[model samples]
Target: MVTLTPLEAELLEVAGSVPDPELPVLTLRELGVLRAVHVRDADAVEVELTPTYTGCPAVEAMSQDIERALHAHGVRKVTVRTVLTPAWSTDDISAEGRRKLREFGIAPPRTRSASEPVSLTLGPTRTHPSEAPADAPIRCPHCGSADTELLSRFSSTACKALRRCLACREPFDHFKEL
Candidate 1:
């Protein structure tokens, strides 16, 4: 296992707990946005972050939150860096995050191999065909029923899809895996 200095460990704790602006219910660590935390000195620290998607509006907010969190934790100097290489994947999201998403009335992304093709549509007005796997079932978060249908390709957020449960007859969001 890797060892961390006292300050480094504390910095990690503080940075990891920064809540995502878009999904306030989950932390940056839970959302898998916090990539790394490196202590440059006793008074300075550097944090790396990866966005859920390119051009995600929450990136700047998340970076600001991280810096704020670190400063509040007594770090005199904090540098927040955005890393785009290797990209961000829903697979990086923690299991706890997935559970929390479900509890928040949002269906978590389905686990699929990297080879599986994802059909996603971008833009505010654009729409895509229902990409929900026909074979892989989707259980409703509100009613816990397998009977659900994709209402639209987009939800309130770009990372989610609109869905409705047939059993409960309620609309909810599904966190799409990218």
Candidate 2:
């Protein structure tokens, strides 16, 4: 068995500070993207990551963030590997991640109760069958109102959707569940 050197341990610690490019509020760890960190020898570190979404363009930027973070900590050689076997879901997000999203002004997905209704009201005047509480809250992140509207099925960000808060009359992003 190989023990991680001080430098390697330090590198992982530093890497933990890096946040997801698309969701700046969520750290890689919070997002459950930082799967593993292994320091080989004294100068090289290997990182395993699982992308939030396969089509997410932020992947390259995330890779760069990891490398830069390790380099900033004096790790000369850093390799970021993407692992997608099990795939990512709202379930993988840590409690901290969910909290971060709330603080960042975005509602996280919701965890569905066995008796919960599948379809949710998107706005005061609109309804969508696609609405389902998976992990994050179904309420508005801004006004914390249950009276919200799903403006669009997709948002500018791949992982998010456009939503409007009826109470606050403000548009915000909602992290969609896979």
Candidate 3:
């Protein structure tokens, strides 16, 4: 593991504190997108960022926000670089972030068991009377009921799916497990 200098560590904290443009409830740190901050010069720094997906529209906004944040923190030159080598997964989100999401009425993404990738299975056009995929049940964030059905594959954003609970009859967005 790389050991961060005191300055680099401080800058990381500053950059990570920027709230996500789309999801204002969570910071970039909590979302796990702020990858690393490298000190390039006394007044310059480089920040690595990983997006939720390859063509994520929020990435540019995130970069600009990071740049502005670092600049306001006294950095003259801030380079926000997009790194996709490792790619990003919902699993990167912190437990606290997940709880915040649930409280925000959005179902947090389900975590995978290991390094294995999580598979996506399309539900039927209508509600599937029973929760067949027992493993990854999309529970209602509002009512904590597992009897939820997908209303749309894409919700407010591509990363989330619209779902409704049979128990509470409430609609919510489920962060699709990456």
Name the best candidate (by lDDT): 3
lDDT of 2 by residue, 1-178 (tens): 5566776566766887798887887888888777778887778889988888786687788889999988887889999988897787766788889888988888887655546555654565334323534343368777787767788868878788888887788888878876
Q: Worst 10-residue stretch by lDDT in candidate 1? A: 123-132
Q: Report the CA-based lDDT of candidate 2 relative to the real structure.
A: 0.77
Please, what is the TM-score per model? 0.86, 0.79, 0.93
Model 3 TM-score on a 0 to 1 scale? 0.93
* lDDT, candidates in the order shown: 0.85, 0.77, 0.90
Clashing pairs in 3: none
User: For residue 44, what is the lDDT in candidate 2?
Assistant: 83
Q: After best superposition, candidate 3 residue 137: deviation in angstroms?
A: 1.1
TM-score of 1: 0.86
Give candidate 1 regions above 4 Å deviation: 1-3, 113-135
- Point out where model 2 deviates above 4 Å: 1-9, 112-137
